[model samples]
Target: MSESPSTRHPRELATAADPAWVDAFVVELRLLGVPGDEIGEHLVVLDTHLRESGEAVDEAFGDPREYARSLAPGGGPAAAVDRSTVAMAVLALVGVVLVPAALGAVLDGTRVTVTLGGVLAAVLLGGALAGLVLPGAPLLALLVRRRWVSFLLAPALVALGAGLVLLLPQVLVRVPAPLVLGAGAAAVLAGSVLLARAPADLVTAPGERASGGGGRLLGLLVLPVFALVACVPVLLVRLLG
Candidate 1:
């Protein structure tokens, strides 16, 4: 006799339904003002549907964001515009730009002038680009959860590398390190505050608890790795010069 679909392994069922898709759906629902309890109930129902019908989530419900918006009475295009998220992305970009410049200035014991043009370019171009990209970043992270570290670090490293390349000439000329460092620190702090206020559940699958020992250990290592990577340019410049 053939085994029943409900009797199949839960993990096997979960594997069939993409965890990233499920997580993104839950996040979208939450963003639309669905309470956590209701969201959890929805996910349970979704999982059962996926298991019983064996239909892909996209085929069954369409895009998670759009589906969630439809469920929310007034959550239309206006609901998508999260001012705080935009601000956080911009602040993060500014921090990435400033931190390296500050480090170079501090190392060289020179004062750096903050040009109006550079500030405008960084805020307008860099921040706008970041704002456009960040809303989708959590979804991307979930999609690549197996390589989460790389997914998280790649952008930061690229931004840091780019900033170093742009600021190298100025640093060599001895711009004030303290001033730059202060600005960078402020931007990072403000960005962090904004991020803390934003929804973080996009990275977590529905019904899954937060990571335990091994995951916590990995999370602890992320900061050190970030710091090490951020300092690479400064170290290279110091050594080569």
Candidate 2:
């Protein structure tokens, strides 16, 4: 008699699970903001079904990404970023802006001040960066569509951005070093607090994560980590120079 999926050794069940398909499904679910633990459970259940019926993933689920959209809490990924998370994102955005401002302040030998043009440049660039997000969706879609294209897409985008930076000149502005750093530190701290208070979006199981859901500490660490990354080089420059 064929063993039921539940009674089968876990190793057998795991072997039956299609890791590639599972990864694609998980990515779609994550983009839809499905909880981590719930995603893990769904993976297990899908694996069980696959074992029991001996069906292909494509046959069992028309498209994993579409299935994820259906599973979204409010029936879509549209409003997945709750208001509080958006607030956290804003603060994080501020942190991103300050990095370039601070770096421009240091590089131009205007450690105490930068021009208004610099700050304005950050703001304008932020909006442009937002536009690039649409391209990211296509990149994610390529996960299932054409994976090799994805492999090339990532580094190409990075290279393009780097090349653009070299072509553009830094705009100087009043880069009040202490004030900028202080506000940056404040923004990072505030963002961290918001992230902590932000609902635990990723309902990960004991040892499972839903895509990029790195849980609370990881969320909290993000701002400060980036802040340090921004500030450390300036500190190094000051110390040696």
Candidate 3:
């Protein structure tokens, strides 16, 4: 005989309790060789199923694991975003490659010009990738709980990466690369703040609303000064090296 919905387990009623867990779940699903689109679609379905089942924001788990059990017979939900893993993998590669390459390019000479242009390029690419991978980590969980705050960090990080890229040339040229690096670091730091207050429907938030909110304001207020101070050591070392 078939089991009733009420007799269903928590996996069947998965919620956002922690997006990071979802991320892990995604990774596990991938391990089982599920496609990306199917993963995303199933995620959407699972989310809806959970909400409908009366799951709250942060509930851990119920009697039986729903998704796991479902996999046993009906198979899991279909993938949502296609090649999402591939896209994320590419971004991760960008982060791994570009940062070092940018550093090398800047350090080509003792009197390197850490211009904004290069920094912007690196950060824009790097930040986005970071944002993508972040959902699978603890940070995503924290952000999911605080929708407003978490959502705020997403764009803030993007802008910060861009801003730093723009600032790099100026800083490395002797005016004080430390300040600029510090600014970039500050942006990253601000990301933490933003994460602490993320929303549930993160993708749905407006672009302006996501970034221009309190997190951006705070980042704007602090990054410049922080960048100046923080980047100094990095500059000195790069120059010396």
Best model per TM-score: 2
lDDT of 3 by residue, 1-241 (tens): 2222122222333454455566556544543345443454555565776667766433524322345335522464433333444343453343333333334435553333545676566556655555445433334434544569867877886577667675655553543334433443444444434433332122111111112245445534443344345446556777787
lDDT of 2 by residue, 96-122 (tens): 667655665656666645434434445
Question: Which regions of candidate 2 fall more than 4 Å away from where they truly are?
Answer: 1-15, 37-41, 70-77, 103-121, 128-175, 203-217, 232-241
Per-residue error at 5 for model 1, in Å?
27
Task: Provide TM-scores for the models.
Answer: 0.53, 0.63, 0.27
Ranking by lDDT: 2, 1, 3
Q: Count clashes in each candidate, considering only residues at least 3 apart in sequence or on different chains.
A: 8, 9, 39
The best candidate in terms of lDDT: 2
| Lowest-sum lDDT 10-residue window in model 2 | 1-10
Cα misplacement distance, residue 188 of candidate 2 (Å):
0.7
lDDT head-to-head 1 vs 3, winner: 1
Clashes of 1: 8
